[model samples]
Target: MGRAWILCKKMFSLTLVFNALLTIACCVGILAGFYWYYSGWNPFAPYLVNGNLLWFAIAAAAINIFPSALLGRKLHTGRFLFHHYFYGFLVMASAVIYVVLFTSVPLTTIFLVNNTSPEVNVGRFFLLGGLTLLLDDLPDVSKRIESGLNHIKAGANRMRKVIVAAQVVTGAFSLYIFAAVCAAMLTIPEWVTPANLILVFTVLITGVTAFIFVKRKAWNNLIVNGEENSH
Candidate 1:
């Protein structure tokens, strides 16, 4: 038990270090890509629309990065509660940013379509992502906050299930959110396009596949439970 705790401690530190590195890399890479794509435009232009879109994309990217980052830490430390709180923050931040962008960015630009009707504004993306993360992490967090039980593995598994479900649900709902945003900008609202729908499905599949690896890992330790004295 002591050794397991030690390993968990190490895992936590390593995960944090890894996430810090990846976050920096992703942020720099994404910003560079944006700059390259919009090189012709004056980045400082006072237009809130484009600027907001850029911000939204960046914020969303950060939100997406949080799980991997937290997982990296949890994989090393086996401490579930700490990372759960971090994930909750990530979801909350992403939700707020998505809502802001929903209002600021025109839907026509997102879909490259024309519409005569006003966009049907439904800022559900924020709620979806936030609620999913919350649903996934709350139990673990509550357990940790309320008690000091070693529920890391069980919590991890629960999160995996919730996240997998979220991935599946988000695949469908995100399109609606995107379509609504685009329709709001005079583009006719449509069902989620095939391309975006495919992307979401692909993500769901990947997450499901990845869960197997993590699932096994949560129990890969050599120590036998209830037999700590023998060691």
Candidate 2:
């Protein structure tokens, strides 16, 4: 049993690491897409170049996305629903702030550096990403849950717990990023542009990676219910 538990832990760690890598890859891909799609064609490109405030927001986004992706991936299916929801909400909130600041009316009142912060852009980013994430994951969540029983059948409760815990921690980190962004928006000067967008992407990615690494390191030592008895 001890041997089995150890094996479970090992597998769990590997899955999480792999998932993290995948999330990073996804962010990079998205960044490239953003650049390619908007660089020369978008009317807002010059605004970003001139305002220069977008850098701060980009920095924040880069720092936050990594963990948000992981949290979405790691959230346990059953017992930690609230945690998952919180993280999802946080992600949505951050996305909304960024999108609104960039796309619509002048964000000067808030970030003080944004170009046109149109009211129509209000919460647009959040609405887009939040809905997409929710829609994308809803089906997967159900599939994962339905299949989870097989894991239990194989005496893989330990495995399940690890995955679930990873999810919870990921969610927590999302909340943290959300808080950090809110704080930054309140305190820091606002700027907008492609460069700033890149910065935000980087910041979000870095933030997520840092949180996952920290949380996973701690989670490794944690013993689920069957740790002692089963082992």
Candidate 3:
């Protein structure tokens, strides 16, 4: 069982790296497409410009770059927590922005005129990719839980306990957001509803709470010394 677990970890890491490469390749392809469009060297230049592929490319690049960077290394506790909170914010913000745009504009008319346009498709693709990446990192989540438990067993400091609690809450909420977004995508119009808005806000609050706890050294002090000590 131990060997199997190790193999699974290895495979998961490889998968993350592979996804990162694919995202980078997509970014490069988008840039190349733009170059061709601007240079008028490609016959599809006009179509590319009309389809708003550039924006899709930019969005794809922006969304995927962090995950790529994150997967490029072995997961560390601090870095992993930071990644989750930061990526959670991005996902939440993007969902909110998308909802606003989707409701305010006549997206149907735009899609009708450019059925093959990459704009809409790209956002969906990126969101799916981000969710997939997060799900793939579940093993790391388990590792974190185990580590936290070990810390408690070792008589962890108050700050450590708080951090662990925050980690669990933040991680669970992040997973919820991932699942919610996936479900939302399957529905018609793919807009964020009030429930979705609530979920995003909750995630934001959880992340901010975790950040505050992480940033403050006051929580690290126990009653033993009556003085704060840096962890």
Give one clash count per candidate, in the order shown: 10, 39, 0
Comparing 1 with 3 on TM-score, the higher-scoring candidate is: 1
Error of model 1, residue 53, in angstroms: 36
User: Tens-digit lDDT track for model 2 on 1-231?
Assistant: 765655455345333333333333333333444555445432223322322233333333333333233333333333235433355456677766775555554333222223323543344334444544442243234546425533442453345455445444544443343344444444544634443343344445444544554556533443323222110
Each prediction's TM-score versus the true structure: 0.26, 0.27, 0.24
> Least lDDT summed over 10 consecutive residues: which range in candidate 3?
222-231
lDDT of 3 at 57: 26
Candidates 1 and 2, the one with greater lDDT: 2
Could you give candidate 3's per-residue lDDT for residues 1-231 as a string of tens digits? 765664555455535433433433333343444455345443123322332332332332233322333332233323434444356346645744663475343433321221223455444444544454444343344556535544542464544565455444553443344344445544534445443343344333333433443445323532322211110
Query: lDDT of all predictions, in order shown?
Result: 0.38, 0.40, 0.39
lDDT of 3: 0.39
Please identify model 1 stretches exceeding 4 Å from their true place. Answer: 1-70, 75-124, 128-196, 207-231
Candidate 1 lDDT by residue in tens digits, 1-231: 977775665455334333323323323333444565545543223322332233332233233333433343333333444544466567667656655564554533322222112221233333334444443344355545324323543464456555444434443333333343344333423534533343334333333323433344422332222312110
Q: Tell how far residue 80 is off in model 1, in angstroms.
A: 18
Higher-lDDT candidate among 1 and 3?
3
